[model samples]
Target: MNAVIRTVRADEWEQVRELRLAALRDPVAHLAFLETVDAALACSDDFWRERAAGAAETGDGQVRQFVAEGPDGRWLGTVTALVERPSAEVRFGESAKVDQTHLVGVYVRPEARGGAVVEALFRAAVDWSWTVEGIRRVRLYVHEENARAAAFYRRFGFAPSGERVPVPGGVGAYEDEYELLPSASRDAVTG
Candidate 1:
């Protein structure tokens, strides 16, 4: 609960990669993330370095990554937000519906799950989103079966937009999209 929550540094790519791989190994990783542990582990060092650089504070408004680090200097969790431009097509769903921030790569170490680490990460991500000039809302998708994640999102004030993205290959799966509009009162919704 005493962890420091802040934006990631460009030089901390190895830390980013380490925390992400730990998240992938979580029991709920199947429901919470798209990438497998093997895939994450196989990524080149350059890939992680570039990713960290892109999400660093110095990267400007394009992308942002936030982290919660314990007093011991170990990273307990991380969340990344990507700024979706109006001129560009959205990555996962139907093309640009709005210029927004797509929240992704959310994770918390199991030992840190209930200690407010996730909430702190969300605060950082949402704060970053609000700083963007034209962002209308901050949105994220969760696997339909991820009740814990859904409950956390709801508790944090995200609402299902009633939009669903089918899992590719027709595996009879879907991910639900949730959003928190910038016009909404953040305190009223998330408290």
Candidate 2:
């Protein structure tokens, strides 16, 4: 697909905002994302500016955002990794209870699926996570009904951690936590 997977720059907040909005509009966004389109659209420019900077390549190393850029320069997909600590307050379902990272905001355009784009994006994300010292593993959460995402995650070597988060106000839907430990080798192995 001739895509470039790289960390986003702080000055590209506009592109970041646009790509996030595009992700929110995808058909499975309800199952894959926590924020609504309207809610994301209502966010001020300053919020996006901060968000972009926080995950930018030049920002602190605690959080990193990677994007798959198409040949024409538009983003095809995006993902972010945030460092976590056992002593820190739980940001998602539960405290990691160990030094680790959580993967979030995963998105890939429908047109870009069934190729190496998603795998490339994940390789970059997981590679960056392992570069951080003392990191035990990388984690992510998928809506139980989002079979496609869960399948991809499993193929990428993440397994269920058995910790679940109830979808707030939802009837029975839940988010299943999955994790991957950085291997001594096999960084590119996705099965």
Candidate 3:
């Protein structure tokens, strides 16, 4: 598979919205994503446009969205990373103890799995995170029941931190948080 992993441009909001909706429709979306396709589709164009702009190069440096584009320019996957300042209140949980990056909205088309598309996307996101000043780690959450995702995250050097977030409801609906400290080493490519 020939694909290029790059940051999205502000003008590509429509594509961003489309890819997100596509991701939501995937079978594993319920386990990996927090939003539904219907909810995403209902979002006004202005919302998507603003989101795209915020993640683009021209926007603030605190957040970034990366995509894997096929040789034909079709989007195969995407992931977003947001930089968390030490003093900033965490968006999803408690206050951040260290400057870090939160990895979220990870997805890849089923047809594109095992083609290094995800690895490329991670490389781009993690590399960008490392470039941010004061960043000490990069973290993400995965549904506990999604063993495939947990294994993939472990393969990428992330480990469970023992800190869990309730799935906004109860015990039966929670996801486990996993983190990768800046000191951890990552293989540039995995077979």
- In terms of lDDT, the best-performing candidate is 2
Candidate 3, residues 1-191, lDDT tens digits: the string is 59988899999999999899989999989888878898998899999999999998888998899999998899999999998876787787545788889999999998899768887888889889999898888989898889998988888878888888876545477788888876563543353
Q: How many backbone clashes does candidate 3 have?
A: 0
What ranges in model 3 sit over 4 Å off? Answer: 186-191
Which of 2 and 3 is the better model by TM-score? Answer: 2
Error of 3 at 126 (Å): 0.6
User: Which TM-score value belongs to model 2?
Assistant: 0.95
State TM-scores per candidate. 0.94, 0.95, 0.94
| Candidate 2 local lDDT, 82-176, one digit each (tens) | 99988877778788788999999999888998888888889898888888888989999999999999998888888899999997666689999
Please report, in order, the local distance difference test score of every candidate based on alpha carbons.
0.86, 0.89, 0.86
TM-score of 3: 0.94
Write one digit per residue (lDDT tens) for candidate 1, span 1-191: 78999998999999999999999999888888878999998999999999999889888668999999999999999999998977986677545578899999999988898768888889889987998988888889999999989998888888999899986657799999999886552762332
Off by over 4 Å in 1: 188-191
Evaluated at residue 8, the lDDT of candidate 3 is 93
